[model samples]
Each structure stands twice: as C-alpha cells, then as structure tokens.
Target: MLPNYFNTKPLADYMRHDLNIPADREAGSLSAGRVGRIAALAAASSAAYAATGHLLALLALLPAPAPAEEGDEDRRTFWTDLRRASGASALLPANLRIGVVAALDGHGAGLATRLLGAFGGMSTDQRVATALLVGEHLTNGDDFPGPASTTGELWLRDVELTAWQIIHHHRRPPTRQAREQFREAWNRL
Candidate 1:
C-alpha cells in the first residue's frame, strides 16, 4: 500500500509558501510561470522521493530547457531557480522533519551538501534525506548542458543506486565501490 505522506498537498503547500510563489499558481499546472513550474517540479520531486524513495519519478518531471534561448543562460537560470527553491524548502524548520530531499545538479550538489552538513545537529532521518537528495540531484543529467564525464556520471549513478538500496531494499548497505566513488565525487566538488 502507498504511504499516507504521498498525499503531496503538504509538500506543495510548503513549496508555495516557503518559495513565495504566487497564490494562484497550481502545482500540477504546466502553463504556470517559471516560478510556478519550478515550484510544481520541486513539490512533485519531494513527494515522489518521500513516497517511493526512488529517483525515476523525480527525474521524469524535469523538462528540457526550451530551445529558443540563444545561449546557456536560460538553462543556467532554470537550474539556479530550481536549486534555490529546493535549498530553501529543504532548510525550512517545519519541512526539515519531513526528511525532504532536493534534486540539485552540478555545483548545486556541493552547495547543498555543505549547507546540510553545516547544520551539524540533523537527525538520522535528516541525514538520510540529505544523502538521498544529493544522490537524486547528481543522477540527473538535465542539470548539465552537455554529457558529464564518464567517471563523474558513474560515481553519481552509484550514489543514487546505493541510496535506493539503503532506502528501499531492506536496509542493504552501500557497496565498497559506491562508498569510494562517493568520496571521490565529494572531494572533487
């Protein structure tokens, strides 16, 4: 059976309020403005992670940046807004206890890691949620303009895979390879 937390309303409400999104914007509406789109995606991503502890649903919500933009600036803005919204929501006092995860990309992963790590007093669930968020963010290629380096991509894949194993596979521990790769990726960041 699905978990009750999968309801998504609370997550949507949290995003809308914390991100200062417009009241009329609906979380499920694709026609909304940029802020609304980001809010919707963040809410959906958070709910999907909390519900299934998997990254696919969250990844699928990412729309490719519109091609009409002249350069990478538009893509950068999209990722930046997404990272900002997710970071804000993740750090909220009320939402912190929900074990929220953010779907970050690129250097945003490093930023989220440092921010969450500095908290220093997070509960075990919070730590797990942060790790899962990092994994989900790293696994998403949409954040990158071009293909990521093979080694970096592989490391991210392992991180997400290990996180899933721990979250949904009866507490199976991360493999030695995954641990090593995660350390390497963290250091590179």
Candidate 2:
C-alpha cells in the first residue's frame, strides 16, 4: 500500500481520467496478461530488460495496451485505435518506444516520482514507467508547475529533435521492425 501522501487526488485522477486504470494497479498481484507477458518476455530477454520495457508501456499508451504477444491478441484495440487516430503505420510503435526511452533516460525514477507523486506506491518500476508514458508538461505550455506543463512532453521533445525527426510525431503501432528500431533508438539515446 502507498503512503497517504501518494493517495492525492491528482495522481488518482490521472489514473482514472487519463489511463482509465485503477490507482491500485501496482498494489494488485498485477493482471494475468500483464504478468504473463512480462514473464515470457523476461524469460526471452533478461528480467531487467523485459521489466523495463513493461514499465514504459504502462506509462505511455492511452489504456496501456498489453505488450504485443504472439497472436496479436493484446495489440488489437489499443494499437488499432491508435493507428486510426494517429494515422501512423509501423512507425507508431517506434515513436512511442522512443518517446518513453527519451523521457526516462537518466532521470527515470526521479521523473516518475515528480509526475506521479510518491513514486510507485508498491512497484518501483512504475516510478519510471508512468513518467515516460503519461509524462508531465506545462499545461497550455505554461512552463509553471501549477497548471501549465501538466500535460508536458518529456521524451517527445528530445526524440523529435534528435532521432527519427518525425515531423508530426507518430506513436502507436506494432511491427517487428518498429520494435527493433524502437529498441535500437532507445539504445542510441
């Protein structure tokens, strides 16, 4: 369980309003799909690597799509809607991945704590994941901490200027090549 301070309205509201997830998502044993996918991917890669990837996905996507599995079962609604909404192809995944990566970089946990409050109630990985995904910004580009920058862009800014140079900034879509590129770009960043 999180401390009372972490139970603030803003954080809870972000989960409910933005992610549409229960604030207790981390406190639970984790959803079967979230756990199974992370376990399998971790087994394939290293626990550190797979765990990191999973956390970032939790942070960025709208409803936080489960990682792409073999059958593409998890990829259906989230990715499809994102593609249709964003008009991206395979590059969507790449941008999201890069956006998350750039957002985290060295400031991973620190950034998450600042945006999410009290870090991850029980899960430390999410301390960074939520930051990379949802991110913080000056609301209306205000640059002040009060209201503006509430919707701030973290990795979005860095990645756009540096890697890929996406003009409109695409994010969402799951292709093997995009996965590889996302990983590669993350490494380069």
Candidate that scores best on lDDT: 1
Model 2 lDDT, residue 112, Cα? 29
User: What's the TM-score of every candidate structure?
Assistant: 0.21, 0.23
lDDT of 2 by residue, 27-137 (tens): 466677755654454343232232233345434433444555645664455455434433334324544554455434421222222223222131434324333333432
lDDT of 2 at 17: 48
Can you list the residue pairs that collide in candidate 1? none
The clash numbers for all candidates, in the given order, read: 0, 12
Q: Where does model 2 exceed 4 Å of error?
A: 1-61, 70-75, 106-189
Question: On residues 1-189, what C-alpha lDDT tens digit does candidate 1 reach at each position?
Answer: 122343344344545555555555664653457566565656545533343433323333333343444576645455444444344443332332233233221112322243334334445454444444444454475653433334334433444553443234222235556878999999998
For model 1, the superposed segments whose C-alpha errors exceed 4 Å read 1-54, 64-70, 88-166, 173-189
